[model samples]
Target: MSERASVPKEAEETESEPEQEPVTTGAQSVIRALENAGTDYVFGVQGGAIMPVYDALYDSDINHVTMAHEQGASHAADAYGVVTGDPGVCFATSGPGATNLVTGIADANMDSDPVIALTGQVPTEFVGNDAFQETDTVGITQPITKESYFAADSDTVGDDVSEAFALADAGRQGPTLVDLPKDVTQGETEVEPGRPETPETYEVPEEADDEDVQEAVEALAEADRPVILSGGGVIKANASSALREFAKEYEIPVITTMPGIGSFPEDHELSLEWAGMHGTGYANMAISNTDCMLAIGTRFDDRLTGGVDSFAPDAEVIHVDIDPAEISKNVYADYPLIGDARNVLRQLFDAMPRAPDADEWRDQCQTWKDEYPMDYDTPDDEPLKPQYVVEQFSEMTPDDTIVCTGVGQHQMWASQFWEYTEPRTWVSSHGLGTMGYGVPAAIGAKLAAPDQEVVCFDGDGSFLMTVQGLSVAVREQLDITYVVLNNEAVGMVRQWQDGFYEGRRMASEYPWIPQFDKLAEAFGARGFTLESYDNVEETIQEARDYDGPSVIDAHIDPGENVFPMVPSGGDNGLFALNEDQLDMI
Candidate 1:
């Protein structure tokens, strides 16, 4: 039996008490329930409506991290869950505070990160009166959250919180919210002081249907060129080893999505790197030419499948995912296996026959890799190339380092240049592509893995979006490296404007930029400025050697653009490569 199935069923249900105990406030019950749920940290800022809960938290063991913005807190909590595989917790006050968390909550929802958010509401009497700092949080968050709750009574505080955690960690995990009114938090009720009962485990199928497994196996066995397309689910399921073993047993090439960057070792023989908008030329070629495809844990988003009509037009697709709704939502799957990725892969491995000899196919792929290798040139001059800087940083950083990136040009460059060899080492804002995700996410990653080095590769525009998060790093004394690619413009937007909008640059360029080094000093953190490509290595080394949080502002070429990009709504073959990339190909 799989580990998930081995857990007792009773442990999955809400705990029930035999008798009511002494009177306790709703705020106290919330803190007690969170402790029972195994939450070690709570990220948020104190406010008027939520003061009682903060008072209760003062006596609890959970470490509270006060962020500069509620958005930062939400992102931090979401990233904590991504790294630890636990439901991250966050708190916010009423009105603006709760509204500020919307972006991060949506981010977690889109990425399927497990998060529990708690917000304060106006007193019950004034709920519909539009009182001071009152907003309909439940209505605002209903669309984005897995579940939303409004605490009507003090007695249900523990039950509501316990249920929220249960839902946040349940199937197709995402964010959950609880809105507690001021009266509810202050009200006293007869409740048990013990922890609420929650399910100890969730059961997933040990194996897929026998018929489906056999069909998939037959398809793979008969195909001349087969490929495995992995997504974030593999990392979430802790199935990298299983994925690698299955690929080797079948002599299949593995291509990952952006969120799935570290799902397979990029340096491995079977690894074809990422396949999507900014993916490797060879990986996209494999996608275009494969005869059979086995997709795991991916929804086949439009970005990955450039044109749904032409994506792998001739290939037979076999999709295995935990959610059945995703089976034929995009590309039709000839064989659909619905179960946990790890368990399904294990069963597939057991049912597979001897590995096939695809020497010709392997050679073809190698030829593609050699002919159109991902490359860039760095001139020995003043303004540095962001790609070259990232490449050098990737070489200097330890293998176990965790890299987090904000959305935009820098994110694409980091995804292209960094070779991720381990699972859960690369975290980023996908789906929503939110700017300002890098700094807070790095702080959360460092909190989850104190011994591992964490770096945030951020573009100037993205960095400034959540630059306030630097205060959290200084306050927590977290050792993180913030490398700002200072291009003085919204590079990705400008690239689009240049390509599609006839180079009408409107509000994309920054005429006056703050000196990041001085800003770091203002935050009581170390900082460095690098203008020349020659100083890249030594400056990074110095920042890494710093005891506390450090920010490195590297001025890069403002005109440099990411190449080998697939034009939006175009097929994989229609690549927008520059002159240098064309020469390499």
Candidate 2:
């Protein structure tokens, strides 16, 4: 009997027993939280402190785009936020990696873009000891973030992350952060994370007070000349269509802030384009002279208001915003309507007694547009004008193409020349004005909307700041056209120096620059050089037609400057169209 019955009882027990669940770590719970929130993509730079989280990401279905630098990852996430109207997620390790994300976080805060940043911290025990790669991420980012948290325990780390994710997209929508200690993330945990949800204390205003809406409507109705100043918040709230309908029904002219470029169709009859320093002359004039201004989601930053005393001097301002804090922070709001843009607009439409008599005002706005047209000259003898390149590309691409830009003269040119007809099509660092945003932003925009074509306009110095982003695009095989307006200098700084610093071009101009096209080729992308008109169309077409990333080194006039400028503290109506006209201020 002993020889015949050799089978172990353990084997039979194992076969009959149910399979046990795999052990879940704190890091796995964090990933599960994001998955529970339906996150499809994450942009990040890997480091030792965050290794556990990266390991967790391995088995998850979320697509993680590894970037060459933490700064690029942050910008990419910011752009993703702009395009999707969701909280774009970014990851970084402690110390330098976390510090690198500061600029992007600040940018998102200023622009009111939704972004979630997950930063790794040194083990909880080593936090104050200055351990390797240690950083006080929560402390550093608190001012810039809508809310920042330190994950104190492994059991609640996932909820901390989930809360951050929800908070980033709630209320006025800004950046949020969660600092995960290494030990906390490595600790064992089996608690499953629930769906992302903001705390009960968090509440967004759905509509404006009825009395305030009525007052705003009355002011607009009584206005002889009313202009609607649409800001980035309109697009962020997905209120573009509502804004358009309201403006059309009332026959009021629409003026966009730089970040509001795509909130209203640029070519529409009531469109005044954008208004600010270096904005369209007509838009600025309209903002300056309006008798009543209905400012939607605009904070009336110094750039937009110029000399506050002179901006809309005769106008009674009706400010509509989701965040009440912004109602009268910069500009006095005669009528404050605090609510979501779309909801408020709908309320205004329903409450209006009748449409205002704005036909005459509309005619006046049209007159301004005809008088101050956005046109640039391109003499065959001179080097190519970047504006021409922008215009040509705009004409060649579909209207839905997404345009991204770095901060500089090229950015102003792209904003000035490209006609945006839809929301979420123009992605740029509006509030922070980050120099190296273009290449990385294009990558993000393309990823966010894979079906839409993407174009990045960057200047030589600006492009040089984060050109490594091109490597990410190349590696990912993203379809994007990067047009570098190589002027061999920090064009904006040079222009400012030339105009205000007695022409002493101190650190602004660069004598030598790498041919960006060749650099693109080195990065395994299609490259083209546009030194003359002979290859302008051919080069751009070929670059746009390329299936993967492409860079065009389009040599532009070194002396070119962004005009229609309102000198700091100058009147918006008195924008300088050229360097010679600057004296008027």
Candidate 3:
């Protein structure tokens, strides 16, 4: 914001001009490296120390989207990476700016998202002096990142960014950090203007041991109630095709973990309806009864697996993941597989010996699906209904479009409504349910995959937290659809209040009705008002058809809650809403 952000440091300005034909500072060199890496956008909150870097970005092709909070910037980048399978980049200042990126970085690390964080550090000479805007960012972020580098020497800025991208986009991709000291950022250097070498290829064991594959095949063949648990790895490893093939050949029910939500079709008969907390009862029951389980690209996080100790007690797990660390990280594996999930499955599919006919296993899962189909009535409920509108939104979009969400009640509703037919179609801060994530994340997703329609299902309260990003979308002219389920309250918290706090509406109201349509228009974006459910569909269809940013403000009952509630701290067995709760309904 300050002109200082556009000025190179006095130290750099005073540096001896390079003897070469043309000379560029380390800032320009780093920018070029990013450009070479195909980084088209950078999410950030600029600051004093990073001014030189910002200066280079002026009219340099790549655009920067400043977020309200640094965390939003990081998360937006994280979501972008997940959506596009490209390394996403975020910039921040030192100290608080760096600290703000912690939660989002941790989320990406936990989920193995490919994110690159570029942070400005105090001058190298000021290191450990507790200099203004100085913090031990690299040390602070080490535990949560796949790899991190701090370049105290300005001469190495380009290389640092280069290596950061390599680590972020390499095998089993995750977060990578580059802390560039202010002094170093200003330093001039002879940078090799070149392409990065491809990361060394690692062999993904295609053929599971014939005996082991046969054993797994026999176990699956023998079980009448077999199930497959897919995870993010399935999508990351591009195993969706193989998973579909295996599921089809075996004819067993295949459900996914939260991150793996869309790896298997929600509409698939073999789907156990997303097994874990907040999932379907029949799916849980199918998990309970299945004697054979195939877990791919999943860590079986607690949310997905009720309790690791008791999870699939009767089943033999055929665990396959690209990362060896994930094989027994959560649920124990009977036949541990360490390789690319897609590659492993491809081999399994080809060498797959005949398994028992799936007539009955598929039949049981189908029966469960038919019996416990997820449902909610029209937009006619108190506290504005969640599912009705979410389902409506889902019905409005094409199957290939993406639906990213913040981690909250609306996220859960989206899980129930929008059925993901492909991987990376639905992204959220699952392990770390951070608010204020939707808008910026939508920006990143739109940048990463401009052709695909990316929508953010934002809760009213959540949207307010990061509403500043609505401007970013408009400024960027991002083709993103924002369908805010306006409960006029922290819907998730209000739900907890209704169920746990005796329906006492304390501080859970957004008294100021945010004219989101006007706000979007204020930023020169298309906006719509669907005050009544009768016009919700038309409004959404119009928004979808629009070529630019759009916001559909659908105001509904405030007391309506996301049902099938698993009371906080309760186990999956205690879910509150189901056919059993229908009597109360």
Candidate 2, residue 112: lDDT: 91
List where candidate 1 sits over 4 angstroms from the true fold.
Answer: 1-23, 193-207, 579-585
**Which one is best on TM-score?**
2
Cα error of candidate 2 at position 176, Å: 0.7
Q: Give the lowest summed-lDDT range of ten residues in model 2.
A: 1-10
Candidate 3 differs from the real structure by a C-alpha RMSD in angstroms, to one decimal, of 6.9
| CA lDDT, candidate 2, residue 227 | 91
Candidate 3 Cα errors over 4 Å, as ranges: 1-24, 58-63, 66-68, 193-214, 379-384, 501-513, 567-574, 578-585
lDDT of 2 by residue, 1-585 (tens): 011111332453345434324438889888988876667789999998888999999988899999989988888998998888877899999999999999889988999988999998899989899899887898999999999999988889899888999899877999999998899899998887766789999999989999989988988898889999999989877899899999888888999999999899998988989999989999998988899999998888998889888889999999999999998898999999999999999999999888788788889989998999988788988988888889889999998889999999999999999999988999998878899999888888889888889999999999999999989999999999999999999999999998898899999999899988889999999999998878788889999889999999999889888988999888999988898998656
User: How far in Å is the alpha carbon of 13 misplaced in model 1?
Assistant: 14
Clashing pairs in 3: 154-184, 382-560, 383-557, 383-558, 383-559, 383-560, 384-557, 384-558
**lDDT tens digits, residues 1-585, model 1?**
011211233663455534423447998888877876767889998999989899888878889999999999999998887877677899999999999999999999989888999999999999999999999999999999988899998988877888888778766678999999999989997674344333456454545798899888888878888889999888777788899889987888899988888888899988889988888988888898888899998999988999888788779999988878789999999999988888899888887775645678888889889977989877776468898888888999887788999999999999999889887788899999999999999988888778788999999999999999999999999999999999999989998787777789999999988999889889989999989877889999999999899999989999988877877666775565683443332
Q: If scored against the real structure, what TM-score would every candidate get?
A: 0.93, 0.96, 0.88
Residue 515 of model 1 has an lDDT of 90
Clashing pairs in 1: 11-199, 11-200, 12-199
Which lDDT tens digits does candidate 3 get at residues 1-585? Answer: 110111232443465643423326777777876865767778999998777788877847887888778888998899888877777889998999999999889989988898999888888889999899899999999999977888866566787788778678766879989888877778887774343333355333454566766666667667766788888878776678779889887677788877888788777766765767678767776776778888888887877776665677788888887777777787788888777787778767766667656677677777867776677765344434667677777777777777888767788888877777877777787776777778778887777677777888888888878887877777777889898877778877877676667779789777787788887788777878766666667778899889888987767677666656544434454456643462342
